[model samples]
Target: MDLTNFLKTGTYLKLKVGLSEENIYSCFKKKDLSKKYYYNKLDKNEGFSYFYGDGALEIMVIDSKIYSLQFDPARYPYILTLFNNIIISHKTSFELIIKYLDIADIKWSFYQRYCHSRELTIKTEENIFIGCVYDKGDYKLSKFQVFEDLYNGFF
Candidate 1:
């Protein structure tokens, strides 16, 4: 599956928003890393989902529905290509990232400012939201998210 498209459009291959947990499970193979990753003896939890391998990944679940997808580039070397010539890397600086978006004429904005890290969000042409978190120490890319719902508020 083209993950770039998924990040930009919020649709995983043929899957769409509001799909059941079972649907998500069927779409991707997942390893139960709960014990290894979370140190939880339990097998599974309704509040969490996993796609652990290669790069560290996490999913948020609400009422058995996929809420969002998150990726950690710092865990593994991964490059995400959003458009023809636009790509995101772990070491990509905030200024460089925003420059890429601006060059592509993509709409984006600073979503929030935090003590240790800050967030920037971009609404795709599909109206889906994609967010990135940058480290305060170096202002490098830390992680990014693809949301399943519309969010207009800022904090």
Candidate 2:
């Protein structure tokens, strides 16, 4: 299929990493990832609930209902701090950021619209409509600032 058609059909799928069911199961049983987190099997009549970090986040019930549970990075303040630090430290311009995203295998498209705004159309490999970036103004900045602006507006 053509790229546009393939994207529309959601034919792309992300490959699984080395993490396995058995490994996840063991971690759950032993509470290896975080002692504060725990999981319980749902009953046949009930839907599964994947709780994370003192039950602050739930994976949400779905059709099959079998899901792995663990600590959520968002639940910890340190995670956000670390993320912000990383984003700030990455000294990459908009051009370099786009290039790096391509190298990182992220599916995205870039466009220049008008003088003040640049558009960044993005999608997941699975054709999920991730979002876009519209550079409102202040396009010229240090590499770090450019990257920060893009990432800050990515969502």
Candidate 3:
């Protein structure tokens, strides 16, 4: 199955936040996914990680429920669409993302860059989280992530 099938209009794979691991796995029975344990430093939650398309797609299941989804722009650059089909490429800048969201009237806030080349995060009113990086004096797209809840570390 195309990894883009994981991305939907409202939620990732149409799976609601906090869906059990069993149900999530049932939906991907036809796909070959590899699982491993991952400790997310941002959320500080250790969960079962299932990767697809050779690390292009990843979903973190915490406590046997869907917790987070991460998409690598480098591999599947054209597949990451958001906020009502706003298409974005790997080259999409942080400014462009803000511009798109602002035009859509979607409320969002800058989390931080932390330091050079680090993940600069933005959280939308709809609970969508975007991760970017500072590169060559511009914030380039790093990864797009959807989590079950806001990171505890975020203020």
Q: State which candidate has the highest lDDT.
A: 3
How much is 122 displaced in model 2, in angstroms? 5.6
Instruction: Give lDDT: candidate 3, residue 3.
Output: 25
What total of clashing residue pairs does each candidate reach? 0, 0, 0
lDDT of 3 at 127: 56
Candidate 2 overall lDDT versus native: 0.31
Q: For candidate 2, lDDT tens digit of each residue in 1-155? A: 01222223332122111223243343354352233222344543343444444442233233333232211222432221111232311122446445544655667543232123343434334322322233454232211101102222222
Task: Report each candidate's C-alpha RMSD, comma-separated, in the order given.
Answer: 4.5, 12.6, 5.2
Question: Any runs in candidate 2 off by more than 4 Å, and if so which?
Answer: 1-24, 30-46, 53-74, 78-100, 108-122, 126-155
Clashing pairs in 2: none
RMSD of candidate 1 to the truth, in angstroms, is 4.5
Is 1 or 2 the stronger prediction by lDDT? Answer: 1
Q: Model 1 lDDT vs. the true structure?
A: 0.55
What TM-score should be assigned to candidate 1?
0.63
All candidates' lDDT scores?
A: 0.55, 0.31, 0.65
Sliding window of 10 residues with minimal summed lDDT for model 1: 32-41
Instruction: Report the candidate with higher TM-score, 2 versus 3.
Output: 3
